[model samples]
Target: MSSFFSRLKQGLSRSRDSLAQLVPGGSVDALSEEEWLDIEDGLIMADCGGELSGSLVQQARKRRGSSIEALKTSMLSMIPDAKEINTSENGPFVLLVVGVNGTGKTTTIGKLATMFGQQGKSVLVGAGDTFRAAAVDQLAVWVERAGADMVRQHDGADPASVAFDTVQRGVARNYDVVIVDTAGRVQTDRGLMDELAKVRRVISKAFPGAPHEVWQVVDGGTGQNAVVQVEKFREVAGTTGLIVTKLDGSGKGGIVLQLSHTYGLPIRYVGVGETLEDLMPFNAEAFITSLLPEHAVKS
Candidate 1:
């Protein structure tokens, strides 16, 4: 646990720095109205979003004890949903992942496969980002690292077809889990989103009740724009959860809480670096402590 906490703090150092610029010393005592306003804006800048930031301020104003602790409880209370992967009812639990390029979609999949593989689950990966030959190669590398098999097609092959083939293979082999990766679809474009819809449809056609989870990956560095991306992807893919990446590279890790607070959807995982093990489950306590060290548990 301490090792994970150390990683969490190291991963969130950039965001902590960004937040420190707002509160300076991380103090919450006798703040002037102007200082309070700066704090609120600072949180929004950290990608906490305006609504959640305002709510935090309101709660802090009335707290009888530590303002930072009160803020922690307030944020924790907003996590109304936390999803756990369960494979009891199905032979191969399917996970469909979508995101823009460079959001670390492939890495996220690889990390998940590694984690599941460590649990002794047989995993199969579908390289559905067929437009880019490099995407398949990248996925192939991670698949190898995770000790999982991959189903891939030549570049320019239909992504939906790859999804279908992967599921069929997983079913035949009775694999524990099958994860599919799709091409990066620009959320604002109708045609691109429509293509994603088609991929989802084909997955359903191949196996009903498959693709049990559709997770949208977002680059947390993009801040509030990540929120818009999630909203759009959810509309197209019925995104069941989120995987936020690039936290170590961006000062916007707070977007996790903002998304959880706004959509109440589960944040399944987050990536802090390029390594397969850099991706970790979203621990609410660790996240809050990393961002607001004043609230961290005393040794």
Candidate 2:
């Protein structure tokens, strides 16, 4: 747990700096205008957004015990418990991975492959993003590294076809899980997003309820724009979970707050570093505690 906290703290230095000043050290009898303004500014600077930061500050002002612990509790309240990621007894759990290109979607899939493979689950990967030859090749490399079997086709093949084939293969081979990778289409591209819908429908052609989870991989560095991405994808692809990547490279970790506040989706995992091991399961409490100052941890 200490090692996890250390890595989380290191990855979220930016948010920690802002949050360290956000919470008052001890209980306060009354809220000063300057203090309230400073608290709001710190949360906003951390990228938690104006609405959440303001409401959180307002909550603090209303509480007699607005101590650092109180603030930590308030901050952690925004994130809910994530649903368990596992193979259902009925069939293999299928995860459909979607996002714009460069959001680390494929890398996340690879990490997931490794994570599941290490759990001793036989994993199968479907390279459904056939629009880009590079995309298929990159996913192939990752699946290989994860020691998972891959089902892909030549560049420009119908992505829906690949999804069907992968799910079929997983069932036939009795694999524990199947991860299908989709093209990195901009959310506004109706044609591409609609194509994703087709992939989902076609996936059912193999087996109903096969793609049990739809996960969107968002770039944590994208900040507020990530909200827009989630909104659009949720409407189009019916996103069930999120994998936020590149937190180690960006200070805007507060986007997690906004994401949970608005969408209420389970954040399955987060990528803090480039290695496969760097991708860790999302734990909301640990994340909030990690973003607090060292003094707060000791307390």
Candidate 3:
């Protein structure tokens, strides 16, 4: 496998191993009601949604067998396929990122820009998070590190205006990618969400079918609250995909499965560590297998 895929496998293996230790395996046929409850509790503790955990356990009960292998296979199958980005387009690929404060939206943008730059694609960043001077400065640091171009207005400027000018520059300069970082706010803020939608509208108007991706960045450590955030953001900005941050810090990586199965939003990327190269593409099979017991892998 490619190095990226291999690193992803390694990171997910760590998470899965941690989860398996929380609920030791026994023959599926011999699982007592108490043991099943323990299994369900383990899934929830791992940040898996209760509904999803219940459903997975129900399916496993129906397919119960003498070996743990059968249970592992069934559990792995419960996870849906990971989503892939469509980089096939010609012009600058614009990604509009949204999320609440402390979700690592700015950091995620910087990492994404670095990844695109490594591919030799020219990138431009829009400091659309005009509400915070710190956010603007953070993105500027990323621009320097990634060696990508950037557009910014003074803090407190209209964010939509910043977005408009950024895309206009991208089209004129013919940059390969344009990433706009928006102000982080709770999804409950109707005015803020409307403003985000307005920014999307502005970008689409400038370049039809542009703002190609609306990615919501959620904190993996937020647990079930992340699911609520996804739903609210999707309704507001029409989020096409998700980038879950801080997976290394939280045992709640299982929220990914719930987000995918609940909202049908493909998890395009996951943040395992803080470095620019730490951001990796999501792989469903590898992630599922990582959650299995080490003995399960050998058997």
TM-score of 2: 0.93
Candidate 1, residue 56: the lDDT equals 84
Candidate 1 regions exceeding 4 Å error are 24-29, 86-88, 295-299
- Steric clash pairs (candidate 1): none
The list of candidate 2 runs beyond 4 A from truth reads 21-24, 64-66, 295-299
How well is each residue in 1-299 modelled by candidate 1, as lDDT tens digits?
88778887899998887776675333356556777677688788888989999998777766655546666777777776685764437678989999998888877888888898999999999999999888789889888988999999888998888999998899889999999999988889898899899889988877788779998899988887888998888888999888888899988878988988888788888888777667888888788888874532211
Preferred candidate (lDDT higher): 1 or 2: 1
- In angstroms, the error of model 3 at 209 is 1.1
Local distance difference test, each candidate: 0.83, 0.82, 0.79
Instruction: Tell how far residue 235 is off in model 3, in angstroms.
Output: 0.5
User: Alpha-carbon error at 286 in model 3, in Å?
Assistant: 1.6
What's the best-to-worst order under TM-score?
2, 1, 3
Clashes of each: 0, 0, 1
Q: Candidate 2 on 70-95: residue-level lDDT in tens?
A: 66677777777786765568678888
Q: Give candidate 3 regions above 4 Å deviation.
A: 1-18, 64-72, 82-84, 87-90, 295-299
- Summed over model 1, clashes come to 0
Q: Compared to the true structure, candidate 1 yields what TM-score?
A: 0.93
